[model samples]
Target: MPTGAAQRPSVSSPRKRRGRAGLVLLGLASLLAIRIWVMEPAVVDSDSMEPTLHPGSLVFVFKAAPQLSGIHPGDVVVFQSPQDNSMMIKRVVAVGNQTVEVRDAVLYVDGFAPDEPFVDHESIDGTHFSLRRIPPGEVFVMGDNRERSIDSRDFGTLPLSSLQGLVLGAGR
Candidate 1:
């Protein structure tokens, strides 16, 4: 009967390693595709969205937002700044030919106060200098922490061309 040598199978060790490597490659490829085409993760940078999004927290954004729902007031959004390529994340207060005014420490949308319960108590009117109607195809954004945010009050309304996407959800 055949002994030690004959008992050894003819499988090559290197081929087994290659098969595992191929599986790993396939997994990495799928992850990359999902990141680029499906979703993107972002880290909150400041307290601008306090009571909602906290600094250093991770959040996911719908990359197809601009192409899908566009943008609307009350939606938390993420966009590239027109003044700078840096990213800017804020809440959509008013969009497209709507007037956004902060007066007597109240936020009025299209001439009516919105149900913004997320605003902090210390926030006495928007420090971003009161403003009038936002231009067509433009959006007025502001941070939840109205006390310390420079949004439309500083650069005026944001052009739709400057938006990146809307944040769908956030992680603690």
Candidate 2:
């Protein structure tokens, strides 16, 4: 080698390169598993959850939350739309075996109305729905913007099996 010449860096061995590629593949597989069984990112596509979640908003859905903490009324969840199997986000208003009704645009569950500060009641008209019982293993859901949302009121209660995850939070 010439004394004043710069030395070239040695190339990594083929075995080392293959090992690094395997590690990269393993890392990617782990991430895919986590997204499938732990958490996932979803985008809101409608005004259904306005005042809480807006169109184009990004949200994280915790897929294991329901199994870890159980589903309850007032919980925001992601589920498959019964009509088209498309994804949707909504709040659980009535759980299994509960009776639900809407009178004068007010929601009543099991003969008592729960406080819904998230709902946009100003846009609601004289909506009246007869009482219906939620069957075991099913839940009734509604959007915060009830006036513009097509939810359980239109499609009826959904089976718990249709639920995909719980909304942990939203991002701008």
| Highest lDDT scorer | 2
lDDT of 1 by residue, 33-148 (tens): 87886678999888888878889989898877777877878888888766776787899889887888777667888779888888864656433346587888988888887877
Top TM-score model: 2
TM-score for every candidate vs. truth? 0.79, 0.85
Q: Residue-wise lDDT of candidate 2 within 1-172, one digit each (tens)?
A: 5778787899999999999999999999999999999999999999999888999999999999878887899889999898898899999999999999999899999999998888867789989889999999999999989998999999999888788899986311
| Angstrom error at residue 91, model 2 | 0.7
lDDT of 2 at 45: 96
Where does candidate 2 stray beyond 4 Å?
1-19, 170-172
lDDT of predicted model 2? 0.90
Per-residue error for 72 in candidate 2, Å, reads: 0.9
**CA shift at 62, candidate 1, in angstroms?**
1.6
The parts of candidate 1 lying over 4 Å away from their true place are 1-23, 125-131, 170-172
